[model samples]
Target: MPFTASANDFRVAPATVTEWKAVYGEVETVNIVPARARISGTVVDVRVTEGQEVRKGAVVASIEDEKLALQLRAAGARVAALNSQMTNAQTELTRAQDLLRTGATAQARVDAAKVQLDVLTSQLTAAVADKAVIEQSAREGDVLSPADGRVLTVPVTAGSVIMAGEPVARVASGRYYLRLSLPERHAAEISEGATVVIGGRSNAEQPRQGRIAKVYPEIQNGRVIADVEVSDIGNYFINERTLVSIPVGRRTILAVPPQAIRTVHGIDYVTLKSLQGTLEVAVVTGERVEIDGKEMIEVLTGLSAQDEVVTR
Candidate 1:
């Protein structure tokens, strides 16, 4: 006679199973901007440092302006001198006209004074315009941030001379994303907007869901690169690495609670409970996964949807 035992039986049923492709990736900023020098001069001031957050149009560095300041002063002086000369020329013209009306000066002398005043006036106008051009050049000496972001590097210091267009600091933009390189063989499986699971193994917090944001058409080093966007990514550091899962497609299969299947002598088995009795049956298993927050084992073979498996 067989021994009797009380057990709970689970009815096997076909459930939707998603086929996921697991890959490794890194947390990265959406954009990196190189804050560079707009003018060639010695760095007079360093206003920002690494890891500092800055807003758009914020001053990051200042180039030496003593030379520019002197040039501006000289230009102003030249304009002032020209204005004084114009004043003297106008006075001479007025005096010449007064004398000609009184018949004390020749008409030709008044005409000469008028020409001299007109030349002086033209010279003053040109001098003022030249000064404005120098003033604009002085304004461009201040280096500014292109966007709001965190500074990654400040390569120059006070008194360091740098050339125009040289990078003064490197910045990582505010938006964050995950960058993954998938195997080339899985190229056909991935698509934009595919569901993704992020940081399941390393992150202590509950794993977050993300979606495939982009897929590059170009393949390199036998892999295809892609980007994923996730929510609540503020806590993650830039360039930090994490595990990611992307589901390519789905299929219907027999799934059961993990407790229902047990391994004996290196072989997987499930006990089938029927009206007659309990019977031990050999089975093959695949990946263990969670469905709707419940852990389930994939029954690849040796199990059917019509069977009732006993689980203690």
Candidate 2:
């Protein structure tokens, strides 16, 4: 019996396609910057956790120095004492000036009183400045993120004592990319600006694409390091593993759409629209491939590029 064919038909042709090799790549950021504590203190509050997204200048954690509070108290006391002394010196200066005007006190005594008032005023200014310094140091305890990114790890916890310049949280800065280490032998083929398919099985129907933004010059451990830039790879994990298909070479082959091929009893068959009529021909199909966002099947044998296969 002749097999009925559908309205749509596919033409088999030898099209040059990229031959891809699958390799594993880990998600990584371009820069890993740490948010450090500007002052030595104990961690008081942590506003962020691992895998949390943060903006630039956002406070990641807060550190509190118990000693800073004590120092501030001492500074306040000194400032208060100097202020009191300055007021008394001003009163004495006024009294000495009045006595000199009445010819009761010597000019030297008035001069000494004026000098005492000036010295006390300067001392009060210096003490106030010292108090401000302590307050500023206490405010520096808040650790802030240097860049916009996701927090990769937090090494400090509440009540943990950390010194100045110690990292409280490490952030993965900027968009995520897939870092791949390919075999050294394929180093010659891999180049910057090349296209790569990302995150799909061995014959994915609709695979996402990525570009090789950078290629490392030196090979490490018999592998060439490369970075692939995918626009929306996400920042869910820092070292998440995934597979990528990179083009290593190119090949020419006769391909037909999957709609043109029908499988029966494990043997793949395709309907051919010949001059006589629609004929069913046994075709040995290879891997199911994705070409230009369309699903296709590789015709290994029993078919030629000139044949017109009917879609069924």
lDDT of 1 at 176: 89
Q: Which ten residues in a row have the lowest lDDT in candidate 2?
A: 1-10
Q: What clash count goes with each model?
A: 0, 0
Q: Using Cα atoms with residue i matched to residue i, what is each candidate's TM-score against the true structure?
A: 0.84, 0.84
How well is each residue in 1-312 modelled by candidate 2, as lDDT tens digits?
A: 011224687566677778889999998888999999999989999999988989999999999999999999999999999888888888898999999999999999999988998888888899899899999999999899999988889998999999999999998897889999999989998889999988753364457899999999999999999999998774337777888999998888777877787889999898888889999999898887766677777889989866878886
Tell me the TM-score of model 2. 0.84
* Tens digits of per-residue lDDT for model 1, 1-312: 011224587677777878887778898997889888877888989999988999988999988656778989999999989988988998899999999999999999999999998898888888888899888878888898989999988999999988889998888886889999988888898999988988654556788899889999999999999999888765566777888888877888777778888899899999997788998889999888776677888889998777878886
lDDT of 1: 0.85
Which portions of model 2 show Cα errors greater than 4 Å? 1-13, 200-206, 259-264, 270-281, 290-295, 304-312
- State how far residue 138 of model 2 sits from its true place (Å): 1.7
Candidate lDDT scores, in order, read: 0.85, 0.87
